[model samples]
Target: MKMFMLKSLCLAAIMLIAVLTGMQLASSGIQKMKGYEDPNLETAVSFHEKDNNVKASILGNDISSHNIAAKKKKLEEISAFNFFSSMGKKLSNGITSASEKLIQFIAD
Candidate 1:
């Protein structure tokens, strides 16, 4: 059924997002900030700015789970966030696909 396929896709998207977020957080040596600094992070469909906590809507369409990282990345190809890549600097963890693009974009 079409509904089943939609549900499966939705679940897959959610899992993918979770895995990405988890990996980003689970890396060693790179102290993870609670959140990255981005003044351009737009108002979220469900956001509140209080007590230094920002809850906002980010990337992804309504049909699927929203990917905040992807949302933060929209039009961010020219940003300064990419220069300080800690990826591959350590022997254990390697670079991520996103970090590669960030490096390339920064180099360009």
Candidate 2:
């Protein structure tokens, strides 16, 4: 019994150490990437801005106004989507909790 207890404690300690080490490694990797910027994204945005400028100049329109309107529309769509998604999640959680309670009550 003593040997079994010792082995179990050793195993638990080893597992704890392994988990902590893995977490530290993962956090450090994430920290290193925090300041990393995607070259592709930067290039794409640059190209888009240049294209908008050319188009606006050709058509004699203000590019800033068009960009602002586009950005506003995009933000509104994102906000609406997030609101509906969060509501759906809450509804699902409520149904799950209710069902669990009902099951427990019936079991009792």
Candidate 3:
């Protein structure tokens, strides 16, 4: 019984160490993005159903590119018209609201 418990504890510790190491490595590498990512399938499908294209494109563009060249390339590649139209209109109207919220949130 003592040996079994020791083995289990050792295995658990090893697994925990591995998991933490992986998390640290991943965290230090490319900073995982935050905020809305529209072109993502989850975002696309959700907004696509509602026909909101602007939000999808802008968000998708933002998600896909961190720089000007990348942005243009991503924009060209992201040709999902259904999702684009659906998100675009919403994005256009919501930009002010979203920006305000962002500003307020950041300030907070």
Each candidate's clash count: 3, 0, 12
Candidate 1 TM-score to native: 0.28
Rank list by lDDT: 2, 3, 1
Q: List candidate 3 stretches off by more than 4 Å.
A: 31-108
- Put down candidate 2 lDDT per residue, 12-72, tens digits, no spaces: 9999868756765665576567777444321111113564454332123345667889999
Which model is ahead, 1 or 2, in terms of lDDT?
2
Q: Rate the local accuracy (lDDT) of all candidates.
A: 0.56, 0.66, 0.60
Candidate 1 Cα misplacement greater than 4 A, ranges: 28-108
Lowest-lDDT window of 10 residues in candidate 2? 39-48
Best by lDDT: 2
Candidate 1 backbone collisions, by pair: 44-56, 44-57, 47-55
> 54 in model 1: Cα distance from truth in Å?
22
Model 3: per-residue Cα lDDT over 29-67, one tens digit each: 434454333343222111232454332232234322246
Error of 2 at 4 (Å): 0.8
> Candidate 2's error at 62, in angstroms?
56
lDDT of 3: 0.60
* Cα misplacement distance, residue 11 of candidate 1 (Å): 0.2
